[model samples]
Target: MSEQPVVPDVAAPAGRGPLLEVVGLAAYVRLGLFGIIGQHTWDAPDLASSQRMLAIGLRVGEQQGRLLAIGASHGVEPVELMRPFAGVLDSFEARTPESSWWEGLLKGVVGHGVASDLCRLLARGLPGDLAAQVVGAMEYTDDDERATSIVRAGVEADGRLGSRLALWGRRVVGESLSLSQALLTTRPSFGELARAAMPATVAPEGPSADVVAWVLGELTAEHTRRMDRMGLAA
Candidate 1:
């Protein structure tokens, strides 16, 4: 058998920020989840896939809480930060079949477990003044409803607005990219994975209009297919 190719290390520059560190942590968590879920399905419990699925749910909850807390701390509304991604959420929702077994599983894993955990974590992470507010926003127990509302609000508001929202979206993307870069720099294995997943010319900077267009195109294609499947559109 041919040996798996080795991944190269990418060193982090001095004076990296907290956001980048957070990104690295998230990447490690995701990689761990992917490894277990992708490779060891047969070994996993048929009832719940793998231990990694549980871990992912827990971690997602924790991360979501952190994100909400951070937004509260900065006096930025969580909904506002999420607004730009509303279109993406709509695409996912519209594409997903509500009655499918996969849908039920996702609701349990992502909506209830992950979303609930995230809200709890966010409340725990917040300071005295902001904690209540953060917790309240996450209080809606229905994961699907909460997710849909947040994403939809973000998309609708962002679309209605002009350059300001675009700028904010750019900042969010920049911060996320910084976080991904930090992960790549710290973990050679993760760096290799990212390189494999992403294109060579991709940079640790804001996404361009072309990137957004490509994303929209993919989402549109999926949406069209989903609509056709449901006999809602051609």
Candidate 2:
């Protein structure tokens, strides 16, 4: 019988930001759990893919958290805050198929969730025009279509039998929005960002209502597409 090769523990170097620290911690936990399971199982290929997925998921989560932290600290719009990270994410398209699958799932879940949360937050906290504009910015694109494809592929590869996994993609977005709002309410920095991003204006009236409605319509359509990609309807 052949001896199974041990996977090395990858460490994050010192002075890495808090976001990376969080990612590292989560990655380690995932690695350890999956490693233990792999040791007891015969499915080596599945185990390998699972590890890749967990690693990439950790990286994406860390990056998103870091972006949010920066945005909150600088009091910038979330879109402006995420622009640089989006560039970084764009570069990962060339990663290995396993890595790409993992990364895409993580990005899609986080992206959808954060956008949803930002929209809901702004709706309650900011002037109607600015809030609507910010919400409108969450619309997915052709690029997002590719990401969802990866997620679908990953799920298929896992050989896990259930529709619940498909539903997870949509659930993450809803949960993320709710969780982010709770986080924002407690985090003074997020409040500062909201204030900075918001323009001084009263409630919407007349034409402003139409503009807000248009923005909401666009956001709703985009979210619907995302849900469809996740194999969820309504």
Candidate 3:
């Protein structure tokens, strides 16, 4: 029989148990994305596409439920956790408004992808059970592919649309990175957790010492891959 590969001891590296605030933050992100996607579904260019996006929104709703469940151990309800950051995501969307159907679709793809990545990476310092759950809650490969398909097909149809979306993709990446950094920096209890999530090569200094830059680099690299998969420029 083949031997199983060893899983590293994430407990020590995780530093401490799950930060309840981080769990709330993750729930708020998905909850907000679900609401925004529902609106986007209604505003889709056609009924057929709207129906498809609505289905995707349903899946996002389910993921939001999972994220909330992760907070169950803390005895916090979904709303309680999400209430603190009431207008956070709305602000993000406002900063990068969509001017067209394709832009709107890319908003869902780029925004949700980057935000979820940030949440999962930051949640890595949590305990084994909660950390695993947080990681699972953020896993949305199928949803990304489905949403990316919508944008990918549209961009493939119009070369000009591809050009426009490529620009939009870059804009969203920058805005998304800025928001993520702001969230980690401004949130009262997240400093240690963010430090724990840093790359192993970097020493655990304060938030200023190469932390934000490394995270931005990691997220930007992932965003570039997603854009490449859709045949769009990063």
Candidate 4:
């Protein structure tokens, strides 16, 4: 496999070349999370750190768009590939509305937490370039970690609120699983890819159910770790 691709930061280094070839699907995630904060900048912060994070988020979004343009050059419209997923994600957010400012932040934490784990697992069988893009997308920026730490601090400060956020986090995970299952059912290729990437814990004749179980187990373990870090119940 080729060495992992490095996405140059805010300076937007030249000669991206083949690195721009792979569409970073994970970039949509950054927009969804950061866009929330962008809409409510007051909720994010007015500090230099927050401004820097916003800049990174914007740059990440632009790089992802450039990748999409590359895909268009190959006669594949990124919109076509992404349309199927937009509905499920929108539905999840609609159903699990964030009631408060912190709840919005927690939503980011939960979103990034589950998404990073899924990307890590799913990238395993992809082509080197694609896998690198996914891994790069999964890497948490300082702002991402800081957001998580803020949520964790909040949970640590109040047992009652922590309990509530714990339940909220689980709900988010549940929604994520539901969305994953929906994807599996709607997108046969996705299921096949997941199965192909799955480890050989099952017999050769094992049902697809086994693969789903393995994925769920891995996601659950990671989610638990995230919750534990936040002093929240899983």
Error of 3 at 115 (Å): 1.0
TM-score, cand. 4: 0.73
Q: lDDT-based ranking, best first?
A: 3, 4, 2, 1
Candidate with best TM-score = 3
Clashing pairs in 1: 61-118, 65-122, 83-154
Q: For model 2, how does the per-residue alpha-carbon lDDT over 3-64 read when each residue is reduced to its tens digit?
A: 53433333223443322222222222223323333332343246655564445444434444
Q: Considering only N, C-alpha and C atoms within 3 Å, which residue pairs clash in candidate 3?
A: none
Each model's lDDT comes to: 0.36, 0.40, 0.76, 0.60
Which candidate has the top score in lDDT? 3
lDDT of 1: 0.36
- Listed in order, each prediction's TM-score against the native is 0.27, 0.35, 0.86, 0.73
lDDT tens digits, residues 1-234, model 3?
245333321211132233666766678777767776787887787898899888888888888888788667667777656656666776688899888877877877888788888877878866677678788877778888888888888888889999989999989888898888887677634556667777677876645546777777778888998998788999
lDDT of 2 at 19: 29
lDDT of 4 by residue, 111-169 (tens): 65575565466665466766665566555556555666777776777778887888888
List, residue by residue over 1-234, the lDDT tens digit for candidate 1. Answer: 245233223343344323232233333333332332343333433434444344444544555555555545655455443432222222223333234222233223232222233223323333444445444544433433432333234345555432333333333333333333333354343333333323346552334433333333333444334223322221
Give the range of the ten consecutive residues with the poorest summed lDDT in model 3.
7-16
